[model samples]
Target: MQKIVILDYGMGNLHSVASALQKVAPGDEVVLATTPEQAEGADRLIVPGVGAIRDCMEGFIRPGFVPLLNRCIETGMPVLGICVGMQIMMARSEENNGVDCLDIFPQPVKFFGTDLKENGERLKVPHMGWNQVQQKIDHPMWRDIENGSRFYFVHSYYVPAENNDALAGETEYGVRIAAAVARENIFSTQFHPEKSADAGLQLLKNFVDWNGQY
Candidate 1:
């Protein structure tokens, strides 16, 4: 059975994400790893996070954690990042008075700003609830999932579509946001796939079956 390691740096919805992965890929071994050594030999790695970027970065500050992630990516092991998990992959986040991230993706995670309106209606700060994602490019992660499928989202900051050639999916909330991104062995989503119903389950399954390729 394949070994799927979900990095538990202490900031994500670990139980929920683990439950979802177990549900989707019953045959695989799903592990919650707190340290780099614990994550060794993982066939696939999942980085999941919730709450503010500052807290998430704190968890990531652990020694050898960042290097482990980089090794996974360099070796072509499939890596899936979720929500704030996705944001941390960027160069930096504008949250917590600005925080430097993994810099895997040379893009900045920006705040939605105070004023946001769609059709003249004031949009909420934490863009909660469901929103449709428009697939920008073809990839294995999109397998069997529809192009405009709605996914659960809850965030005040987003990765803007600027200098992001790895943009894989887009969703609009006031302005356009990079809902998903992919580069080589890595794929990440701004939306929560674990909470996104069947479509989300399908996405998890795709990651399980993905061979770290396009």
Candidate 2:
């Protein structure tokens, strides 16, 4: 049986992500992995987080799962990162008065300007609500999902990856932001797929069926 593990390092909306995975991939064995051993054995993995970047990294450290995460990425397993999880994959973050990250993507997480505005109208800081995402590149995870699909977003900061090729999806919030990023074995999204209704579910379904292709 295929083993799918969601890293349970005590910092994410674990229940929602797990429930979404179960609903999408009922046939697969999904486990909330709190140890490196469990996480390392998974055929596919998800690193989901909801909180400050510093706290999230601290959560991983408290359980000593950083090596496991590095191993997963090194072995090229299918991995997905959501929200703060994705942000921490970058080099560093401006959050928590500046925090260092895992440096998986060689990018930095930047905070949205407080004075952000659209058409001379002030916009919210968190960029909360349904927004259209433009698919920046073709990949297996985006196979069935249509371009400009609306996904739920709630974030005060965004990753503007230095490598344009790594960008998979783009969304605008007073300015363009990287909504999704991808490389060989990793795919991540700033938007919450579980909260995105039909389009979100479809993306999750695609992820389950994906073979870690670019």
TM-score of each: 0.98, 0.96
Cα RMSD of all models vs. native, in order, equals 0.9, 1.3
lDDT digits (tens) for residues 98-198 of candidate 2: 99998888888999888999999999888899999999888888878899999999899898734556899999888778999998999999999989988
* lDDT agreement with native, every candidate: 0.93, 0.87
- Candidate 2's C-alpha lDDT? 0.87
Candidate 1 residue pairs that clash: none
Superposed Cα deviation of residue 162, candidate 2 (Å): 6.9
Off by over 4 Å in 2: 161-163
Q: Candidate 1 lDDT, tens digit per residue, 45-139?
A: 99999989988988887756788998899999999999999999999999999999999999999999899999999999989989999999999
Pairs of colliding residues, candidate 2: none
Q: In terms of lDDT, which candidate is strongest?
A: 1
Tell me how far the alpha carbon of residue 97 in candidate 1 is from the true structure, in angstroms, after superposition: 0.9
